[model samples]
Target: MVTLDWTATEIALSLGISPVGCAEISGYKTWVNVANEGLADAVDVGRRQQPSLEAIRKLQPDLILTSRYRHASIARALGEIAPVHLIDDQENEDDMLASVYQSAHQAGAALSRSDDVARLLESFDGEIEKLRTGHAGQVEGRKLVVAQPLPGVPRLRAFAPNAAISGLLRKIGFADGSQMSAQPFGFATVDLEGLASLENDSTLFILGEAIPDDLLHASLWPMLPIVAQGNVRLTGIPSWPFGSTASLKHLARQIVTRFV
Candidate 1:
């Protein structure tokens, strides 16, 4: 298996598959909680933008798979060493589901629990429908404003229009109050004052690892209306913020059930 992002790597491990090797953006470990599996022995080939070709050549993985949207060149470079598959991420519900199923098709038998995958998907669909009906009377069809605490970086990072959270929101029929739309995987910076000025209620799905104190009690956060009013839903997910198509469905369900 081949992966270019933390989410894909996490998915591979969840599927009971391991890459002969892989790469990601620098400091991946800084944000993602490394799973206890092949990742223990897996080599960090290089950063997403610049993977070490020499290292990948040494690993000589049988097949490489990458999200088509994130690292095209890395996928191409990996292809020289082995067969590379670029998994596409789509916006619409149908296209997104196709992207996921297509990913399962690519995984072949590496997925240890095909039954689990199917069950998770079904569960997500069922919960989504239930939530849609369950909350109709109280939610007033609110939209979600997904945000994440920017540690050390002096600004707030909000999900762009097409990031993972945004995609999931649209999937579950939440109104898209998307102010940022140029990217499928992107973050835009905001100051505390700026965050207060933005007035889209809906739900706020905050992403990132579980650093509660930095996020919850930080001086900048307490003043925000979203935080003060309990409108923000903080989700303790990894830095890459995405995973296998099936794994993503799990994340999607958790987001909707918790925030929607």
Candidate 2:
């Protein structure tokens, strides 16, 4: 099958089914550099915004899976090549994990691997339980804030309670540490000043890249408790936040490695 959604590709990879082709295969550092380590044979169909129809025509996949959030606009055109399946991420907006679970089921049914998806989900649950029990004391009353600094912008995109990352953090026993209110779409833009308002006991989980070198010397940087106490942690994995059970387990393992 052809995959336009990174999350779908991750799910397929987790199930040990290598896709025929994928979009933006060589562009992303995490997806190419880290995520695609063992699976190097999938063809690069093209970029996400403008997938090459000619390249897709050569493969003639049985079906095409596209993300409603990212590839809805091209669904009509893609349908001409093969049947298009849409992963509706917006269906269960309030519960990110459930949304991912449903997506896994959808993909599994489409791929005729429902049993494999079930086993993967069961493994994910088991892994989460192990972390929850092992770190029960360490994370009981702890608070964490997940943030990714916007490129070329002097602001951080804070993941709110509604975000998939925030839900995963909560699953591991961390409370939402941001002072700002949750947004419908699960993100809020906060400058350094706004980040300073989090609780002193709160830890910060930085994603994508390290805190900018220049930000380290800023006058306000040292004022944050998480910074002063060295509670700030970075997730080095280049996985998508809006992903399946496999992604959650990958993220949970990262957190356990850093904090447990």
TM-score of 2: 0.90
TM-score of 1: 0.66
| Candidate 2 C-alpha error for residue 82, in Å | 0.7
| Candidate 2, position 34, lDDT | 34
- lDDT tens digits, residue span 1-260, model 1: 55666655655665567676768533545454445455656777887666677887787777766666666755666778887766554423323444555555444433445676666456656765665666655443566666767776535677665555555556566765446554534556766666676564645666655534655555877777776777767566653344544355545556665643
Once superposed on the true structure, which residue ranges of model 1 sit more than 4 Å away at CA?
24-38, 74-77, 90-140, 170-187, 208-224, 227-230, 236-240, 246-260
For lDDT, the strongest prediction is 2
The 10 consecutive residues of candidate 1 with the worst lDDT sum are: 89-98
Model 2 lDDT per residue over 55-174, tens place = 988999998886777778888888999998887655666766677778888888888899999998888878888888889887866888877767765567787887877777788787
**TM-score, one value per model:** 0.66, 0.90
